[model samples]
Target: MIESILPSYVVSEDLFEDPPDTMLFPEEEKAVEVAVDKRRREFTTARLCARRAMARLGLPPVPVVPGPRGEPGWPSGIVGSMTHCTGYRAAVLGRSARVATIGIDAEPNEVLTQGVLEVISLPAERERLRELARRSEGVCWERLLFSAKESVYKAWFPLTGLWLDFEEADLSIGPDDGTFSARLLVPGPVVDGSEVTAFSGRWLVRDGLILTAIVLPAPATTAGSPPGASPGSELIGS
Candidate 1:
């Protein structure tokens, strides 16, 4: 899949593979968990791949943990997010100083459908997909839209410490300076100084996978001290 560097983040994808025995123990399993072993393996592989990507940029490996509502907990001084789907995995890492949050998503070409597309996309977005379909045969525009939406969610949640519905964000994708640029249209006070905050980044397709990367502006406060939080307020990792 695509492995490319953006201004502030690195985006890459890998074919899903089974994790080595060293990564898991037999005792920590159940029947359902065993049934989803392939997903577990892919997630493990994605984490390793993400670490390698960060190292390439001379950043220290940040430990990741599951925060409230299942968002990733990046180590102090860094922020990042990851996403994976069947047969593919992707990760994004960014320097905390430059970006407050970063997210990447990848999808296989076949998992998206027209019906599924209708549910997640707006009318204008659907029209754009139709246009892309008309101009380029066999490209999975729906899947790309879904992946872009997902990437936006991952990037937005952490900084705002709030959950947003998929409909809350609008996306525009186009060619920019030799790479695909994605623009985000976010609703509500989540974004700084406006109801809609826009972010732009690049994406590409490689090896039958669609890869996307986005960099989010950092919050003004530190991890435990989110903006607008009064003293002793509960900390939520959005």
Candidate 2:
């Protein structure tokens, strides 16, 4: 489901069930050493998926340890993101030379947990959600909004190495297009010499899951010109 929404240059792996054979790297195991069984299972499985993605990129399996903010640390020259929720776990990777950053998230297709929408959403976003809900009762737009912001932060953190609060991004979701765009309310990151003022991503609701993804291509280069002369490639699934 995730691959359908990403570009060919990206490698994506998602697991519906924690593979019984999933094992963590020695270094990775220490991150969750004292966690409950559930935490260990998801942490281990997400890394397992990440390693599988690395192998697809023609790289060897390595420990996918978390950074200070819990962002998965990727191998040099690789940019990626991972997410796990309920029965879903996923990892997406791209070469740093071809892709600037990637962010993804998965959530059960249901209403937001009580009080979550208020904390994460801007007032404008909440009004839009109501309109979307009225238009299509099938999708949990509130939950989708939360997932989109999570993707925004996942992508934002890697570039800026700073925190992006939930209320920092104002989202505009398309009720029919399976897409959304995030307008960064604060100063955006500068990627490959260009300032990223906003982000556009794709979303999907299928079976019992809602998935969202954002991929920013690395800037194109030329012999005489500086980077960011043109986007490395068109944004995926735009």
Candidate 3:
């Protein structure tokens, strides 16, 4: 059975338990493939875990179909996203009536190299990470930033149906009520003309696994839009 870790998020590790039998595909298989074994495995595992979690939530499982520009499309009535890395797999689900966007990500705690961090982080965000590192020694600030960026992508794409670059959104992380809170510095017409929104949320590490969830307010409704066409989108950035 799938397990619910938060009100709108759930997790499963079945993918880590049993890797997919890629050998089943013929050697001459012409399907597109990624050479990174670890990433392929993680993606496979994450999808399996998400399917099981959806079942536990009493929601019909939705096949994650990639839309134009690589965004995932969910079955009707639910807004959600998934992420998996190394040994972790997770999923987030939101009811259409309650939330317009939901994003979740899981990653292992490890030191991220300075070079890698620089590539993914904005200057202001790097400064905040420096402060956070000074206060909390050994925290994986770079990884968290990377994951948060990924989550933002997952959450944003479906709403705008547009691709966002890693530098488009800025993120800040700090201690809050015994957990970490992330605030997003998002700009442009995509955010409904708002310059920034505090996408507040929390994270926890349990048994060597780190899980984070961020829920944004449902976007304002338009005069003549489809029932599920809100301005908000959900994502997983790990």
Candidate 4:
């Protein structure tokens, strides 16, 4: 189901439930060793999803540990993200040569808790969400907005190594195209000699879940054979 929303170059794996055999490496287990049963289950299963994605990329299974900010630390030359919510867990990966960064998120298709939307959304974004709700029925636009911002932060952090607040990025959602655009309200990151002040991504709400993804591609014109090791030159399918 996750593959349906991503581009062809990305390798993705998702699971609706934790498998009985799910196991975590010693290093990976340390991150969740003290957590409750539910936290342990989700952390372990999400790594399982990530390793499966790694195998699909023709790479051997490796322990996926957390970085300083709790982001998954991918192997060298790999860019990826992991998300888990309720009954769903998913991971997506792409080669650094073809892709610069990747962000994917999943959330239950339910309206935001009262006052929660106001905390995560800008006034402009809230106004836009109201407009979107009028156009589309049966979809949780507020939750979708939160999910899109989560995805944007996932994609933003790895490149900038900095934090991005929900209020720092303004979003404009499309009611018809399953797409959204994010405009950075602060100084933007520069990739391959150009500043990226904006980003575009795709979203979907289906089967009681809301999924959002963002993939940025490496510069294709770099002098190196495969490509330069710099950040993305352009958004892929964004």
TM-score, cand. 4: 0.93
Per-residue lDDT tens digits for candidate 3, residues 1-238, read 1133344233333344545553322321222274366655655556666666678668665566555565446678777777666666666665665555666677777766658887887898889888877888555777777766666666666656667777777676644432333344454324455532434445655555556665554555323333322234321122
Candidate that scores best on lDDT: 2
- Location of the lowest summed lDDT over 10 successive residues in candidate 2: 221-230
* lDDT per residue (tens digit) for residues 110-202 in model 2: 998899899999999999998998889778999999999999888888889999999998998988878888888898888767688888788
**Clashes by residue pair, model 1:** 100-218, 157-238
**Model 1 lDDT tens row, 85-195:** 666665666566645666677777655764787788888888877787777755577787787777766766776778766666666666333223333454433444433
Between candidates 1 and 4, the lDDT winner: 4
Record all residue pairs in model 2 with backbone atoms less than 3 Å apart, i.e. clashing.
none
Q: What's the alpha carbon RMSD for model 4?
A: 3.9
TM-score of each: 0.73, 0.93, 0.70, 0.93
Decreasing lDDT order of the candidates: 2, 4, 1, 3
Show the lowest summed lDDT stretch of 10 residues, model 3. Answer: 23-32
Model 4, C-alpha of 126: deviation from truth (Å)? 0.9
Which ranges in model 4 have alpha carbons more than 4 Å from their true place? 221-238
